[model samples]
Target: METSVFTRSIESLLDEDEYRALQTHLVENPESGSIIPGSGGIRKIRWGLKGRGKRGGARVVYFWAVRRDRILMLYA
Candidate 1:
């Protein structure tokens, strides 16, 4: 399921290939992102754009829902 914010905002930030790569990375390494303080269990990871490095990339915020075995993508 996709939220309106994700579909409208986040989806437009990346191309199809970049989005797929992000999804694949998340699926393989759910906890790879650094944990954000005071945000419960939320974590943040960087994603580079096609012509940019990770430093010039976007920040993807997500949460690992262990009980449900799901990763909730909160923001980007």
Candidate 2:
């Protein structure tokens, strides 16, 4: 299978912690791709999200598939 390269927006979205898990997920299993129909072209790819640390904060991590044709690693 051919792998798509990631976009800059998607790259910028990643924080230090987020990138760690995300990178591993991609390296180990990058074939997983979720498609979103009729999304104005912005694919809702389920890359996976993370949670806040034990320090206590609104842990709301999100995975997103930003664009298509061009590789876009989506996240929140």
Candidate 3:
């Protein structure tokens, strides 16, 4: 639920519906992504773009703040 200006700008690259879907999925499964090495607890997920498979989709980097039940979307 928290994002920086850069993150917001990066998210704008996604279609509106795709962005919403990503948000909903993250809210429901904050731990869905695997922890990224050398980056604290930041995680990354492979999000499929429209008409593209995982191999060609975007990588969404985020941090889950469990205590606050919030996800800090960092990049996409």
TM-score top scorer: 1
Instruction: Point to the candidate with the largest lDDT.
Output: 1
**Model 2 misplaced stretches (Cα beyond 4 Å):** 1-8, 35-44, 48-76
TM-score of each: 0.88, 0.35, 0.84
Q: Tens digit of lDDT per residue, candidate 2, span 1-76?
A: 1223343344555566776765565545444444445554333334444464433322212233333323334333
Clashing pairs in 3: none
RMSD, each candidate, Å?
Answer: 1.3, 8.0, 1.8
42 Cα displacement, candidate 2 (Å)? 13
**RMSD, candidate 1, Å:** 1.3
Tens-digit lDDT track of model 1 for 1-76:
3355666657768988888899889989999999999989998999998778889898888888988888888888
Q: Output the better candidate (1/3) by lDDT.
A: 1
How accurate locally, in lDDT, is each candidate? 0.84, 0.42, 0.83
Question: Which pairs in model 2 have colliding backbones?
Answer: 45-65, 64-74
Tens digits of per-residue lDDT, candidate 3, 1-76, equal 5557536665666777888898899999989999999988999999888888878888888999888778888877
Error of 3 at 72 (Å): 0.5
